[model samples]
Target: MGGGRWTVVLDPHRWLELRRFRGLYESGAMSLREIAKETGLNRRTVAKYLSGRTPSAPPERAASDRPRRRVVDEVAPLIDAMLRAEILLKGAVIHERLVAEYGFTINYQRVKMYLQEARPRIAEELGISPGELAGLHRRFEVVPGAQAQVDWGDEGKILAHVGIPKVYSFHMTLSYSRDPFCCFTTSQDLATFFDCHRQAFAHFGGVPMSIVYDRTKTVVRRHVAPGEAVPLHPEAVAFAGHYDFDPDVLAAYRPTGKGRVERQVLIVRDHVLAGRAFSSIEEMNAAFTAWVPLRRAKVHGTHGEVIGLRAVRDHTALRPLPQSPYVVAQRHLRYVGKDCLVAFDANLYSVPAFRVRPRQLVEVRATKSQITLHATTPGAGGETLLAAHSRAVGRGARVVDERHWDGLPTGAGRRVTAGGDLPAPLQQRAQDSSSGSLMALLNRAAATQVEVGRRPLSVYDELTGTRPFTTHPNTKETP
Candidate 1:
């Protein structure tokens, strides 16, 4: 054996054997041969061992005791207790605790070495160790437009429908590229869930190869068995099927498995979705659609590349958008009343009275610029349409039903003098009852003005003057 020391960890018994042999050699009581035979060591080797020499230790044993501690006995218990309590077991915290509580006066790293001896304990406390964590990883690849991540971000609220409060915002992201799709959503219900997906797809301009969703109730129903399987929610499954992409779900309590998507949600909340105010979901989405693509045009932190350009390159892998968005929200069915009006949201909206039937399924769309209604029927399951209305408010003759003669209320007629021949709304002369009213006075002025041509001051002066003579002789000749 090349010369190296073997640590004698057995309590002084083994050391006593060597020492007694040394004693025999010093006292001249026994030969090295007798001592070596009794101890089962080569006589020369026993001589060397007793003489304070060493042999190589086994590899596993050597690694463990490599860093000898200055104060292992003094601080070992304290390190054990700290780890048991799950206190953060960094060297600094251990050192502070040792000095403050246990009266340890050793150097900080002396405490560190003691703690290092107790490393196995601390690693167990942190759930997965560095080695385990490193091994339990997944390699995520983005097939460009083929895979994206969706999640909810921060929420906001405002008056959505009188007393009803709406969620202000949530976040969605692309998995492969770290691209974000974010917007406001009033609910995590099926309607809003699919709507957010619609907006996200529009934002990304394509579907992903697959989408990864957490086992949120908004997406998954319930686990069939603990750690076994989770049933995808009916609505979410239908939506995924409609999109024609594979649906991937992380296990029930395994949040770390989807950390990539979770991180994207946070980044979008911090950068894209927060600190903005919007009046309605539509308005919020409009803002998001505009803002997100411009953000994509900029560079990314992860890839150090332009996201928009990359997205363009990746888009070929995605499925084309459906001709129409999926509709899962319940719609109201009502009639255009005989008065050519249908009331919704505390406002009277008129549809073409004749074109609407008594129990027609009509879709009412109240957008920023207009309010419209489309009649729906069963044969095409809302494919066949009947009539539509141009939304009107403080009307200047807005057409509700084409059959109605005057579609607008009085306020509307009062605002327009579309034909200049009609009297203006502000200039009514009904209060003037005198024969010398402005009309009568205006008649006399007209007679003088025709004779005076454009000499308006002369006509006014002649009419107001005490003199009654008005007509010139050249003006009367033709009569």
Candidate 2:
């Protein structure tokens, strides 16, 4: 308190000096000048610091007692507003904006320091504590196979040169072991989501007791009011049922709940995708597969154990995979064509003529090797099978069954061929024609249709008063 630069709270050493001076003065062993000379202070300043009635101990000053004027002080309200709006603006960005838009003349470092102190207060006002902020995520561990966290990370413009704008990675990490599995996909649709789950399960050699997922639409169908159970997508429920694992969805706006997979997404990006170019999702996935083994061998930072060793314990605790792998078939509503076929995957699949009408909506359930069509029925089961066709291997292929078109008009129905064509009866008749004398026979048969009088050349000769069997007009012998 004696000098502008010193306060008991800000400069505890100066408080110690004050205490020493007070002690020397009280003992009557040293003059104020002597204490000042020893402590390196003016006698008046030393006396001012020692003026307290009985210096017991330096009292800790309240944080509010610190100097109030700051560059951030002028913009604290703005920063508070930004934080309250859930805008995660960086301190440097805020500083630049303050300079450009608000004409703030303060330095960036002061603004940054103020922001660090102000965020806790701002979060408190928003009904969330500083510890719950996005940056101050807490770490928790789950028992082996007790849980696994799933997440998706977008790799932007990864294959832009090959015409792909973006790709996503599905990541799943065992909570206890921190073991991770990731795969790249061009889509985040329900099919791809379920497919990723299967891939991760296969990689881990089994399914976990429960899998935690973000509030993605593929997992959580909708966000319900607080205290109400979060509704899960029906397909997701079916998939979990098939695997005999529970699906745990994190609450809305709480990605840290699935922190294991969230952190692994970053690790995979940095280790596998950083500075890497891929022409296809398959190639990116291959890269991830090759790099994941390296990660598994490294020592985990938090667990302080070899990840592969920990993962061995995880795999042993995981639930055994079902006798059959869960089939994740993509469902789509397709209009049946007039040819008694439904189009799927750029291939035409036959639907029984009696089962589906032209332009009627039929649900196509497509798996890797099969495409099954189901017609919605009014009964309890909801859908009736129309047909199941072998999945086509290439585009523009037509897969048909002859029985499907049994009800078509008589000649309209034809034998099915591997080429997907229905051979017409006329084509069959042409194929059965004899090879020899075909041209001459065709000419003679064509002459049968020509009109000829009964008299023939003799009638023409009598009409002209000429010989009846004249060989030539120029001979004139018969005349």
Candidate 3:
């Protein structure tokens, strides 16, 4: 017995005897000697336990209850501050920063253990549950085709020469199957947004009944009161109408509502973009396409079913696409410049000469590779297509149709090559009209001023005799 504390492993028989003895003693049917003899423990040990004077807890717990002293204890306040600053930072990162900046000499495990105790306090100070404050997310599943999640990820600068261009990936994932489709673009504009949707639907073979979206301006026009229905952008409403899908917007500041897509975005960045270099957007998308099939073939973590097999079930419940594919073009009102050209995407497309007047308001519909200019009001038929040009990919490009400018005239008054040229006789007249008209007019004026004129002012003055006397202002006229 080391210092009267015998740490012995009692057999089951000894435990049974202890309980029986304790029960008999409690009932006042056994003496201390008898109980001790029956239990085989010393009389003192039995008295220690029965008197409620045993060690307050197990020996190990007593040793563990004392606060652990560590090198980090010297900067306990700093650790608390780090926790307050960013609760999500792991102990390894905190330790790294402390060592690098504060010269902390401590192991990572000690910091990790300390953080476990400090986090709940920090969370309490912020008036939130530790779980909520720590962003503990719950997993959710929806019926196949019932919902899909859409989001955009900033991919940093890729095609820098094309413009220090920031690329973004548009990701849409079916919630049930975890099947994801991604497209990369240089913009997040409404046109690009809808274009990605079209591409995603084509890739998936159909559209989900509803698409979950964060409060992006492309979907929600503006923020509204809590619990109120968010107002959808007009273009978005039209797009949803065309696709026959409901737009489900997540509450502001809640990203976990669409965690599947969020997770898939990280998955793509890790598996596709990480440590990979691509010079073009097309290459990135092609890589994604090739990788998608392999990803689908693997068993998903949440569903425990092969993603591709699950997707087969997902596709059956999806809404069918409309007969004619939705025309996803951006329409902008453009002014026809005096050059008989309409400016679009930094390119010029000529309208038929005399067909559209300069400064005329025209609607320019731009698809990925085509630009179509239309008159605001329909002609005798329907919307008049004044011009259509293959969309130029480069800036300052000119897509001119020489036939469109046929009605325009050449330099001076010569008509261009009913090619808007003046008549042959009219050209001859125009050629001579400038100099000939001026010379003929001058000769007529000279003839009119000839000295043999029938009635001159001087002749009339002489005939009258009195008016010829000194009419100059400097000479005084006699009254």
Clashing pairs in 2: none
**How would you encode candidate 2's per-residue C-alpha lDDT over 1-479 as one tens digit per residue?**
33443444445764564565465577776677765655455576566556764333443433564453433567888767766654345565566557655888765655665676777777777777533234767777788989998988998887889887778888989998999999887678777788888888899999999998878888887889877999988888899999999998876788888877888987787666654457898898898787766777778888899999999999999998888877777788999888988888788999888766789998899776678888866435665888888878657999989998886787755554433322376445545777423332434444455554476776788788989534885766745
lDDT preference between candidates 1 and 3, better one: 3
Ranking by lDDT: 3, 2, 1
- What would the TM-scores of all predictions be? 0.39, 0.53, 0.56
Residue-wise lDDT of candidate 1 within 259-367, one digit each (tens)? 6667765554434333334566677667656656556766877778897777676666678888876654423455676566666544666655445554555776543
| Highest TM-score model number | 3
The candidate that wins on lDDT is 3
**TM-score of decoy 1:** 0.39
Let me know the TM-score candidate 2 reaches against the reference structure: 0.53
Each candidate's lDDT (Cα)? 0.59, 0.75, 0.77
